[model samples]
Target: MEQPHFKSWPDVAPTLIAVAAGRAPADTVIRGGQWVNVHTREILPDHDIAIAQGRVAFVGPDASHCIGEGTEIIEADGRFMIPGLCDGHMHIESGMLTPAEFARAVIPHGTTSMFTDPHEIANVLGLDGVRMMHDEALMQPVNIFTQMPSCAPSAPGLETTGYEITPDDVAEAMTWPGIIGLGEMMNFPGVIHADPKMLAEIAATQRAGKTVGGHYASPDLGPDFAAYVAGGPADDHEGTCEADAIARVRQGMRSMMRLGSAWYDVETQITAVTEKGLDPRNFILCTDDSHSGTLVNDGHMNRVLRHAISCGCDPLIALQMATINTATHFGLEREIGSITPGRRADIILTSNLTDLPIEHVIARGKTVAMDGKVMVDCPHLDWPDHARRTVNLGPARRAEDFVITAPEGANRVTANVIGVVENQAPTKALTADLDVIDGAVAGDADKDICQIALVERHLGTGKTVNGFVSGFGYTGDMAIASSVAHDSHHMIVVGTSRDDMAKAANRLGEVGGGITVFKDGQEIAMVELPIAGLMSDSPVSEVAAKAQDMVDAMAACGCHLNNAYMQHSLLALVVIPELRISDLGLVDVTKFELTDVIKGSA
Candidate 1:
């Protein structure tokens, strides 16, 4: 029952105006640049930006008016001075690194702002877990806003979470200093139907005057979609096509296009702007989820921007999408989006607008990254021992835990298999026929069938749900296991060999929590995700190296799907379509009901 110190936008307005009028000594100044003004969608040449006390002061031909003694000046060399990129929606835990490490990984890529939802951790450790992430995010130099996780189990009764988020929790979080809004309301069905709980959360966010994030995973744009919009989510990031983008914007929602480690959605959706010529301001760019490997090896928002350009989006338009569009969506536009007066001094200097190689990065009027490297120290949180020790398998797992028994007297049976779709989150509802061996249903690798298991890791529960999956092209004697399963964050292990699968699963239990790959009952690779059994405390490069080895191990096993590990982990996500598994049982995602894993007919 304590209130935190809060600073509203109006409180900083006076200081900003004083800085702009040259009445205050500028803290930093960037000289001789072409300013990319996203506010008016115009490029102003020969602009000089002056900063004071971590806020933009003046932007004009010359900030000679505000220049004072000892002011640090950065020569832009006539390059494009653009606002630092903002990921409209993302998951820091997906990087398999803590927020500190994730920030260190993306700073060089010029992402100064992020709006993240820690639903994965919420499903694992609940509100305390969310608070850990929220506190750590605030300690960083860049802007990182926490949207109170709207869904813990994701889909109400379809899956059970370690802890459930209540409407009271949502109301309490709205009072937090860092709570920007509600996290993505993944319950599209509940929203459309006006579910009381969902409506209450939205009403709480509205009462607090904050934004509500959206996730309409279904491609259906009919009356249901209209009903969802009427329920009050202001933005959506699940759009994969131009039509999806256009429809969301048409219904008074900002269209968020994402390009994550394995998800290539921006290129397909940005065409709504470049070719079809939809208003670019309504679209925002994000990397929804990127692993540490992708964060270190490739880039963050920079990668999204590059893919947007290849898709024919004008460079400035793409920059705008990554900047002001995101800021405005979160109601932080005047506070930090544009590099204008009365905004946070978050700016990036690039040599070429088209290529966009980030040269200098500044956040809060301080040089944070320079020459493709982080210049400032990204702070870390003091994660307690219990926080890292989250994988709670009641006892050691055994091969017998994976055996699936078919219905009585059934020699062979057809089963509903969760099909892994490469490079996308959704799975296909695939059915496979399998033969019974010794009264137990077995996976048929020759038929491209493999076993999928969801292990209950929260609260020392020994529940394990075993099912089947396909489309990995996996051949003989291999298995993959991950503690990074989506939403619920349980351990999901998939393999052609039961012994290898058990080895991979047991290895994670031994290491506290992490991902492991095995071949013929021998471990080949592992990445230690000790933080809530979902992210690594290790450096991005070290984690990326292990991730690469894990990928290579999957390739050696004859599985040829792109980032198949990501797809495999999502098999238990009951929210996404077709079929999925959870701690309870196999989920018929389409109907949002539990279905028998064994097939009655072909």
Candidate 2:
């Protein structure tokens, strides 16, 4: 079914004016609620909101004049009425669900608007994939704006994607409906060094009068950062410290502090607002990459808001950061992010401000969710079979395919290992001494080191780049493989035994695409993400259940890093520092170049 198209303020001004003047009765009246006015940053008690033609007609001390016999009355009972929450930056595919399923999952959590980047699918299927995501987003009950993906390989020359997004692609996408802006420019160095393609994409977005999303992953706050800020991106979410937040805000860029499944970056950077006296309006709350389990069990933007409050932010201020501040960043404040006249009647009814219990949610003057349940259907797209079958790991992989051959005569070798940092996106570059067994480097389980391989899944190359990773705490003959590897969407297989690694890789291929875990030659757990090998077509509840089981299986194998699955998928991400594996080889992201895994052999 087609969702209602949002009417412009001019188109609905007549009806809204009629209802406000009591010349015509309103369609709905929410009475006896405290208006949490974000514009004034104060709560006004005993206000009545009148809605007409899916837009807020009036919000004042009383709406009795606008009410008639046919008007539907909802008694707010003195509850706090705030604008529906908005996520400034997120990737819907990260939730392991389609756009429709993601909206269905978060509507009950009070998130009525989202600015999402479909770059995950773009890496797998290119421009066609982005169009599919945009088409589905337009059919949702709540706001789901699509940002044309800016970086597919994330960093050209550093990584390879199944499809490359060109400047022409960005220009064409800007003309499409629902294209809010260009997605996060993950190639910080490219923008800093003035790469022609990156600049052209930003130029296209600016020419279209759209915001450009930023992702400066580097820790440097020097001239390079200054150059990047001058390149025209408006926001940054890769900040992990107070200094990072302060630097971005000082440069006139909004600092987006994310609290996703594995990235706990809010507590560290929110201090820029809590203690450092930085302007809170310059900060926003978002979930850059949340798993389905986090959305179902914890919350969406609500989770990030609560975390901000716990870190010493005022509840009202936090709400503004999640609502108006976000909408203003995308130039959408007049259309959303407020409980004012001439705005979409997207409001949430909650009893407490601090805890933020979403008792009821109304979107576009219609009650869409009540008592943690969705009242409307989130329409789905008919994804073709070719999109579902994306895991093309040419020719069956074998144990020999994952073997890391040592140098000609080395008995002991110091190898560069990608050290996974818990609750962060950046990895630590560490060195490990491993014994060479029959001219092959072996993983030392006692030392918490495991073999990580990047199997090229996009093209039928059948090439596997092997390296070592630490911090998963795995200590058995277990292996985990996923087609949800970030940026490039290659297959990442980490395991102790080569046999188990091969089994896990083949299992994902056989299942079309998904995450799978194997132990002692037996499949322990799996979650099939048949859509582009990055998301499932199932309901969020079903996906969350399977994800929980996958987490349990990882724990059973002695892997105890919080949300280790996220870490595993990012092992192949070549954009973030300091060490990562890609289809090319071991990459030292800090240097933005592929380096040898064996320290002294190459």
**Per model, how many backbone clashes are there?**
0, 0
The worst-scoring run of ten residues by lDDT in candidate 2 lies at 1-10
Q: Over 4 Å off in model 2, which ranges?
A: 1-5
Compared with the true structure, all predictions reach lDDT values of 0.87, 0.93
Residues 1-602 of candidate 1 have per-residue lDDT tens digits of 11122234476667667767888767788999999998888889899998876878789998887778988888988999999899999999888889988888899899999999999889888888999999989888888899999988788887778888888989989999889999999998899899999999999999999999999989889999999999999999888788999999999999999898888888888888988898898999999988877888888999999889888888888988999988988888888779888788889999888778989999888888998788988778899988888888887788888899888888889998888777888888888889998888988878788899998888777888999988898887888889988888889999888888788888898898888989887888888999999988777778888888888888988988877777877787787788899988999888889988887633
Please tell me which predicted candidate would have the highest TM-score against the true structure: 2
Candidate 1 clash pair list: none
TM-score of each: 0.96, 0.99
CA RMSD of each candidate after superposition: 2.1, 1.2
